[model samples]
Target chain A: MEEAKEGFEPKIIGFTCNWCTYAGADLAGTSRKKYPPNIRIIRLMCSGRLDPMFVLKVLLNGADGVFIGGCHPGECHYIKGNFYARRRIAALRTILKQFGLDDRVRSEWISASEGDKFARVMKEMAEDIKKLGPNPMRDKIL
Target chain B: MKGTELKQEDLEGLFKGLLDKKAVDCLVLPHKVGNNVAYMLVKDGDKIESPAASAIFAPSFGVNAANIVKGWTIPERVGIVAKPCEIRAAIELIKLKQMDKESVLLISADCSGAFTNQDYADHAGEIGDWVDSAKINELKGKGIAIREACAICENRLADVGDIIIERVDGGKVLVAGITDMGDEALSSTELSLEDKDVERQAEKEKIAADAKKEKEELPKMSSVEELEEFLRDCIACKNCRDMCPVCYCKECFFEQPLGKPVGGDLLNLAELRSAIGVPTNQLLYHLTRIYHVCTTCVGCGACEDACPKDIPLTRLYPLIAKKVQEIFEYVPGEDAEEPLPFITYEEEELEDKLR
Candidate 1:
């Protein structure tokens, strides 16, 4: 495995839904689960509220990676919010793939009860991103 | 379905008849304006007889006509004669409630492709009376070619219009009514209609296959650096957004004052990036615009035409739209009753696409 740079810790932006992933993240904290402290979380009411533009903005502004956590399929607090999110994110990923930034963005379905899963995903993502190095956009002016 | 075969010379009379018979209060068709063809709203029957009017079959494309008649609710039934792409855009707009379906009649024809406005203006006189049969290869032989978007457009013939006009051999055209409104309008014209099925399926399929080959051969961008280089000349004029028929937002987010940073905020952005590009947010603007219209873009190429930088936007937006539409199994403007992929979703679909 390629080792990360000597002191380069990846900067990740996490968008978590209030009803599920946010609470799950809270659970991870209260339970004292150990994970990397690289992510800055922004809570939204539902996954559907997350526009593809939000991901593009952070990535273009030099975010090393983006993590989107939503309710599991059929378990959305707003009926079909996560289902809609699935399609939007998939479409966004296709666009991202064209720019070779697809791997930098990840989406997952973590329920409020899955505190361990949340912590594990964060750890895994941090390790993968560290090896992948910083976002090329970080050096770009656009 | 019934149709009437009329000579090319008789088309003007037929259009005049529509207005004379009160089938439509006005006609939204291409008209000769100075040296270029432009969409005009003509209400007078005699105006159709003028030599300066009625260039419906001109090998010219300036703007998507759907944008011309958007939100038309004047209660005057307007008959819009348009190419397949414009018709498709109109269908999408109607579904989005941007247009009232009851107030307009869609008249589409098999497109033989068109030259950009600049190209047409430069070669209009040389291209005389051969638009209906101007094949791309043949035009190229004459030292001219159609726009890249038109050359590879698979939807050259639309099956969703209220009325369709098909050009046949022997200088004659077949006009068919695909809907009851079209049928009623045709019956009122007093032109005898007979059972005639337009059989250009083989021809359409050939064009489609050729288009598929062209699409596969298009240059692709696989990195942000490449994309930035490709858009290096962009001035952020937003002409592409302005010409876009589907970008119907009255107040675009990119144009909002809040989105434009100044003074301390601008300095902070520069500091965070170590440096910032002048005329900032070009990438953000384009990415957001593409994502916003990816679902509804009809690939009309108006944005490509309107671009002052000649950015080859058609190579990006339409190509991405094709992939995005395929993922959702949705074709924009294919059917008026079909819901947009963004507005509606199935309970169980695209599971593999999402991880």
Candidate 2:
């Protein structure tokens, strides 16, 4: 895969579970962490409600990468929400691989105390996606 | 208990006896209908003409007779002669509580395979003898291919509890009763079946091996743009969903399309993205339906046959369904006691699936 030109900025869609990941993002903002402003976050109450279709549609609609941040396994405020979401994301990744888009979609556990980790993940994801260049679907579907 | 074996000519008599002996009140099986073979519920003993020999099996992997009997709740037993896949679909429906299992007797005949409805009509018209088990190779030699789903079907034989009927050497119909009820049913008649378990087991192993090889060899859609191009010819017709035995929804979401505003969801999306395709929701409809049926699809390929666009949906669904179903270690219709994977999960399961 050819890398994008210098200064190419990746567009990422972040679906953050409000219980943990949303709080983590908020903590990062308050902490004035240095990270790329590539993600537009959508706050979901729980990761379980993160339907695979939503991730798929957003990716097909041309987002350079999709970032799903959820509560750590067995620590979901809603109990078992992240467990279910884990299974869905895993299944989703396999589907993504079939479409050669596996690298652009990832799930991470970012608790409220992991604000530093949240900022770091975004910066890393943005860099990787930038290297991958624009999503091919960006032209076909959008 | 031993059951007698009868010639191919006696299958009609066996059905007639089932009615006369009051074993079942109404029978659901394929019979001659105009020039085609279709499922019919028959109670009259006189109407039990042997199904066209070729037509009996040619309808397999296409029409799902299980869907025909899905809504039955009566106490009166109904005998259903269906392909093994249909029987499997029926078993899945039974576990879903979608069908009355106690009121039905599953009858499966020997299945070589079936062509699509149009192909079956053309092939049958050309050959003139509905389907002779011996001539199936000859039929294939004439440039007719079996439906894609049938090509990889592993469970072609009826399961242990089914009343399996097959034409063996010398044109003799071998009827086997594997359950107590099936044994009693056969005992009442003048037929018996010996155990051909070793042969059938070998055949099943070969089918499974072939399926594994085929899955590995499939050409997967490798890009979102390629996927969109593959699906671009869709005409928004819901025929595939309609023909799906597993899509047992009472009223589909598309059936009652909600009125849209001047600048609705599609417009909002288009404005955000700069462009969007019209006849919205085809991709959503297909993906949603696949998610819903992945564990219970039975790999029957009826949906593929119903596609008007000639989409190689059979190629798409079975491969994807295999991936999802493997995650659960579940094969739909393979077991009656097995709960659907989506609803039943162990606490320790799918641990590696997470981040």
Interface RMSD (Å), every candidate = 1.3, 2.5
Docking quality (DockQ) of candidate 1: 0.68
lDDT of 2 by residue, A10-120 (tens): 889999999899999998999999899999999999998898878777876678899999998778999888877877776676656666787898789999989999999
* Most accurate candidate by lDDT: 1
**Clashes in model 1: which pairs?**
none
- Candidate 1 structure quality by residue, lDDT tens digits, B154-261: 888746678887767886778888888888888889999998887778988988898888788889899888888988999989999999999888788877764667
> Model 2 over residues B1-355: C-alpha lDDT tens digits?
3445677777788888877887778788776554456787889989877643444554434468888877677788888887888887888888877777678777777766567767766655654533443455576687776677876666666563357776567767667776666766666664445554425677668767866675566666877666667778887688888888888777875665431213576677778767766666676667656666777888888888889999988766766776777887888876577787766656566645543
How much is the lDDT of residue B355 in candidate 1?
Answer: 44
In candidate 1 chain A, what residue range of length 10 has the lowest lDDT sum?
A1-10
Model 2 TM-score, 2 decimals: 0.85
Where is the poorest 10-residue window by lDDT in model 2 chain A? A90-99
Candidate 2 Cα lDDT to native: 0.74
Checking candidate 2 for backbone clashes, the offending pairs are: B3-B191, B3-B192, B4-B191, B4-B192, B5-B192, B54-B130, B54-B131
Candidate 1 stretches with Cα past 4 Å from truth are A1-7, B49-54, B129-135, B141-143, B262-265, B271-274
The candidates' DockQ values read 0.68, 0.44
